[model samples]
Target: MDKELTSSIEKVRSAVKEELTHYLAEQRDYLTSIASELIPVCDALEDYLLEGGKRLRPLFAYAGFMAAGATPTRTDIRAMASLELLQACALIHDDLMDGSDTRRGKPAIHRHFESLHRQGSMSGVPEQFGAAAAVLLGDLALVWSDHMLHNAGLSHESLMAALRIHDEMRIELMAGQYLDVREAGEKEFSVERSLRIARYKSGKYTIERPLHLGAVIASPAQSEHGQLLNVLSAYGLPLGEAFQLRDDLLGIFGDPTVTGKPAGDDLREGKRTVLMAMTLEKASAPARRELQRDLGNPTLTVQRIEELRTIITETGAVAEVEKLIEGLATESKIAAQSSAIAADAQPFLLALADSAIRRSH
Candidate 1:
């Protein structure tokens, strides 16, 4: 990353972190006041929210606001920071749904609750208790996202505008997630379907919607900013897809230490990503048979993972995905250069394009 871009990103991260700290602290107090039993929930939520994350959604929103030629206030930042809570909701539920044991190298929300249940020697199934807790906590996070945004002190007009975008984003996120879960169960592998899943499940909310959120918040008059919004969509949509593609690559090939997940975890989970679809398309019949047999086997050994990795490489899927990422990123940058973008925000969007795709984890 360029030094200037890096600094700018760090500044946004810091500001959002501060806002989260303040917001979570208030919620913690509220929870503890209600009942001592709720203390555990508060603690878990604090840890999950405050721990490591890229804060990419909020950053994109801030960039969008900047691109709209407005300087954000603390209230604006708080509104943007609400997206993190929404993400927390998504990730916690996702972990439970995927049966993931860990996130960011720590026990996932469900597993964390499961351990608490076991430690307490609670009756009934610990796994069931954990699943229940994870679901409730995810719901709480979703609720809090709405509360935080509503109380963030935006003008009534801006609040209404932001709400519209927020609602649409959440709807798209759920639709995308459903598509992904549905696809995972099906045996067929379709590149086009995988790409669609990426766009809805992770792409739109991850980048495009955030940008739209910020842009709308900056200039609440939707009609006046239609052109700018269109331009931003043009920039954001492809970049968002590229970002997910990079994430797909990271899931398969990233180092455990950096990615905070087991290597080839996506393979074990049978994520029907574009890369996997392409590999299945191009692989020899024998190789395809091997992959089909082993792709979702949770007990896969390291040696078998290496074998699958080799097969994916031999099919040239990795190279193809990389090309796709580059092309999408280029499209994003080209859109950023449009006259619709504010002069100062153009560089941020350009640097962000690089930041989005040029990552190992």
Candidate 2:
């Protein structure tokens, strides 16, 4: 399943790339090529947008299109590319909101602004202004993404569906972010609690909406949509949740160099993720105390981080969570295989389910 889905996604990537390039060459053109002041900023934004990502949402949208036997067209490609732009907008804002310094091996947008402000002997610039600029830049990308979707030359129904999905994604993700921020300071973390956060924060918005958007674009009729939506939800929900769980594990244990960020960033942020919840669930009282004391403390030493890791492991939480992810992946695969969805989509759905539990980042 993973191999087949990966092949299809790779095939769709050409469309995504072409659309992004066209957006730069055409829509981003200056009034005066050499004399224009906005060209540099536009170029910088283009570079930033093209920097790095898995292009997962766009791939999902394309896969759904193919599953529904929609002919590949320029409009389809353009519509799909807008998903990536929407994702980029979300990431830029997410990084700023998290105050993250890096993403995909380079400085995040705000950090980039800050660095540019500090470079070439530029001084006396307030660092807060950099973050402010990034916020506005993200807002621009968000609006641009919506515009791209709207002008994709699709049927009014399809365009409306796409726009609705985009709007719902933004709102739901913000709600999830609020939940995340609220949960970080709590002590009584549970598996159910963490799962609730995962569903809101990543599962539905990340997987379901993209699938539905494409499904609607490809086959918006009521008679056709119910089955497709159900299959996609079945295939995406558990996989999305497991994906976030794996990411949570990686947050604490992954190599910072490979992850392209500081290790223990999630810990410092005190994310109330399933792994952390499980640690407390499986640990003894004193172990919980140690975890609470050192887990999120930025000033904690390396020794303390290691100790926290050991305690988490000793409680058997990590192993338990790993098994749960495997279970969820299997469940997704089963759902994909049994779903009364389009025959063309089954293979891709199964492959996505199988691969969701295997990603390293």
Candidate 3:
């Protein structure tokens, strides 16, 4: 089963990657005549888009195209590229907001430009100026993504729906961020609060909206359309929750070398995660106090993180969460199997169901 999934994903991934590369090359030429200054900005956009991991939004979009019984035309390809551009924009802004130095094992675009500035070379752009420049670059990608989508061969109605999805994704993500910030400051973080943060912030944007946006683009015709959307929601939300849960575990416990970030990042950042809330709720008094005191400390150490892990285990949160993750995966598979989504899409959908909860990073 795993082998078949790996093979299928590789084929889909190859197609998606080719489409992205073709789009980037076309974009590079388009921007070249504008200015030498614009060349570097275009280069940066191409770099990150080409270098990203997963391309999950585009993947979901691809699956949608398949489910609609359409081979990807130029328009479908453009939509796929647009999704990645939007994701790139979000990541740039997110890294800056989080004060994140690296993304997927490389210096983030802003920091990379900042380094070039600090080197005291030819042009003498200030480091802060470079960061500002990167911010503008991200904004351009965000705007351009919309432009590409608007120009794609979608009906005006379908395009509007996609735009609405884009708007909603942005608002929900921002709200989720604020919720996390506020929750971190609260004396007692609840399990319910943590789940809400995951759903609004990471889950909805990552899974739910992407899947639905694809459905909108496919524009199914019949009573089955509503049912297909509902099925996707039922599958995506839980899978998203599990994805975040695994992320919470990795945030504190995963290897920094593999994850491309410092260990204990979430612990130091003091994220009010679902895992933490669940652990807190179930843990003994002393264990709870230990978590409360240690969770957000900027000076947290590996040894302390290990101790926290021990305490969480003693509370059975890990076991409980794992069980829930399995249940969600099972449910996602069941939903996908029963859905009216095209038969050809089943393997891809099932692949996602299998992978959604099992990935470590």
Question: Which structure among the candidates has the greatest lDDT?
Answer: 1
TM-score, every prediction: 0.98, 0.90, 0.88
lDDT of 3 by residue, 93-167 (tens): 767766677888888878877876677464656657667867887798788777777776777766777777777
Worst 10 residues of 2 by lDDT: 31-40
Query: Whole-model lDDT for model 1 versus the true structure?
Result: 0.92
Q: What's the CA error at residue 248 for candidate 1, in Å?
A: 1.0
- Could you tally the backbone clashes for each prediction? 0, 2, 0
Model 2 lDDT tens row, 64-123: 665565655789778878877777777888888777888877878888878777773465
For candidate 3, the TM-score is 0.88
lDDT of 1 by residue, 1-361 (tens): 6798789889999999999999999998888899999999999988988888889899899989999998789999999999999999999999999999989989999999999999999999999999999999999999999999999999998999999999999999999999998999887999999999988866688998999999999999876348988898899999999999999899999898988888899999998999999999999999999999998899999899998999999999999999999999998999999998889998889988888899876
* C-alpha lDDT (0 to 100) for residue 88 of candidate 3: 81
TM-score, structure 1 vs. true: 0.98
- Position 53, candidate 1: lDDT: 89
Prediction RMSDs, each to the true structure: 1.0, 2.6, 2.9
